[model samples]
Target: MAGKQASVLVQYIAVRGDLAEKWPMGAIIAQACHAATAVMHVFKDDPNTVQYLSDLDRMHKIILKVPNEGELNALVSVLESNNKDFKLWVEQPENYPTCLATKPYIKTEIQDYFKKFKLLK
Candidate 1:
């Protein structure tokens, strides 16, 4: 009999640097939060998400930054082509894409998609 192996689940969030540079810190954080929340809600029933939430104290997230909206959109394109599950949050009224976040997934399973980006400081 084989025992179940443990996996490191992580949520990836990419926010537009241009927005973060110009917008208030709170607003920038809000964009990332919106994307994160949306993806989690959208994928709440996913196996990885379920396991990720099952251990809330160990939840892991990687926050990266894109230079601008175009760069962020470019990342989204790659994610879509790879069939990665994510939420691209577009603020209404202004209709601007501000941030994107992937649902909780095994780190190794999706790390390649974000290797080119740097962590958001």
Candidate 2:
């Protein structure tokens, strides 16, 4: 038991930084939240999601920021090419892409894809 590595599942949520110019803080946050919740619901049956949820207090999520919708869409394309499962949340009425969230994944398996993005402040 002493040598076993710790559990390190993570969910990455990237919100758009450019949205602040046209949207209020509350709406921007709601987009990220919606994306996060949507991914969880979409991938609820995934093994990692099951394990990640097993420990509610220890569940990990990395919130990062994208400069605008373009970067967000580009990231989505990359994820699609890699066959990674994720949810890209688009705001209704405006049809705006605001954020994206990858379902729970083993940290090391997907962390690199997000290195270019900074922590969402």
Candidate 3:
């Protein structure tokens, strides 16, 4: 199961990377957020999804390493779209953990967003 999950995560990351390269920064972030959110949904109900979440965690770290308003805004936009309340919490640096905890929801929102955006087949 873990192996299968890992494979799925790898696929997701590869797709995300491709999107990042091809799309605008905001669009990439939006797509990544959507992808991560989809993974979260799968993770919540399927043990297979947990590995994908782990992949997302790693990707999140990479995203954080980037220094740009467009990137940050895109990331924050996804979070905000997932949870309106997150806007307030995200503003407070100390509440980062709380914001992290909301990743699942953010991920789920991203998944839905992807569907709406027609990023998913």
Candidate 1: pairs in clash: none
Per-residue lDDT value at 4 in model 3: 42
Expressed as tens digits, the lDDT of each residue in 1-70 for candidate 2 is 4323234788999999888557888887888889999999999999999988999998788989898989
- Compared with the true structure, what per-residue lDDT tens digits does model 3 show for residues 9-100? 22222122333444577654554455445545544754444544556445331132222334444545765666522221131343321111
> Which ten residues in a row are the worst by lDDT in model 1?
1-10
Which regions of candidate 1 deviate over 4 angstroms?
1-6
What CA root-mean-square deviation does each model show from the true structure? 3.0, 2.1, 11.1
Report the candidate with higher TM-score, 1 versus 2: 1
Q: Worst ten-residue run, lDDT, model 3? A: 95-104
TM agreement with the true structure for every prediction: 0.93, 0.91, 0.28
Residue range 58-85, candidate 1, lDDT tens digits = 8999999888988998999999999999
lDDT of each: 0.91, 0.88, 0.36
Whole-model alpha-carbon lDDT for candidate 2: 0.88
> Candidate 2, residue 58: CA error in Å?
0.9
